[model samples]
Target: MALMITDECINCDVCEPECPNGAISQGDEIYQIDPGKCTECVGHFDEPQCQQVCPVDCIPHDPGHQETREQLMEKFIRLTASK
Candidate 1:
């Protein structure tokens, strides 16, 4: 599953650079994770870098956008593929 940023985020700008996929971005107030680009760091890292660096633990599994490991991997490949 992809991860999402909750409202509890302090917007401290800690999680932005940690994302290997560049999925995390600063929103109007809180930071947001783009589900289409998020792959939980499947191809780039051993684990989700954003979640690991988050101070408030605001990043959580997105149940609404649930996907299997295979699907996530495919998504990762497609995202990284150059146009």
Candidate 2:
């Protein structure tokens, strides 16, 4: 599943740079994770980098954007190929 930044995000500005996929960005209120661009760090790291550095613990698996490991890997591949 893609990770989501909840409303609880404190805008610490830490998580945004931690996202390897560049999925997190500043929204009107808080940091937002683009589901289409998110891979939960599948091709980049063993764990989501954003989640590790977020002080608020607001980053969580997006159940609404669920995907299996294989699916996430495919998404990661697509993202990298475009770069």
Candidate 3:
């Protein structure tokens, strides 16, 4: 599943650069995760980098963008291929 930045985010600016897929970005009020780009760091790491680095523990799985590991891997492959 894709992760989402909740309102609890502190905007400390730590998680953005840590995302290998570049799925995170500054939103109007807080950091936001692009569901289309997020793959839970499946191809880059065993854990979600954003969730690991967020000091406030604000990033959480997005129920709206639920995906399995296989789907995430496929998305990762597609993303890398376009690059």
Task: Name the candidate that leads on lDDT.
Answer: 3
Least accurate 10 contiguous residues by lDDT in model 3: 48-57
Rank all candidate structures by their lDDT, best first, as comma-separated numbers. 3, 2, 1
Higher-TM-score candidate among 2 and 3? 3
User: Using Cα atoms with residue i matched to residue i, what is each candidate's TM-score against the true structure?
Assistant: 0.94, 0.97, 0.98
User: What stretches of model 2 exceed 4 Å from their correct place?
Assistant: none
List, residue by residue over 1-83, the lDDT tens digit for candidate 2. Answer: 98898889889999888888889999999999999999999989999999899888999999899999999999999999988
User: Can you write out model 3's per-residue Cα lDDT over 1-83, one digit (the tens) per residue?
Assistant: 89999999999999999999999999999999999999999999999988888898999899999999999999999999988
Clashes of each: 0, 0, 0
Higher-ranked by TM-score: 1 or 3: 3
- Model 1, 1-83: lDDT tens digits are 99999999998898999887889988888999999999999988888999899889999999888989899999999988973
Which residue pairs show backbone clashes in model 2?
none
Clashing pairs in 3: none
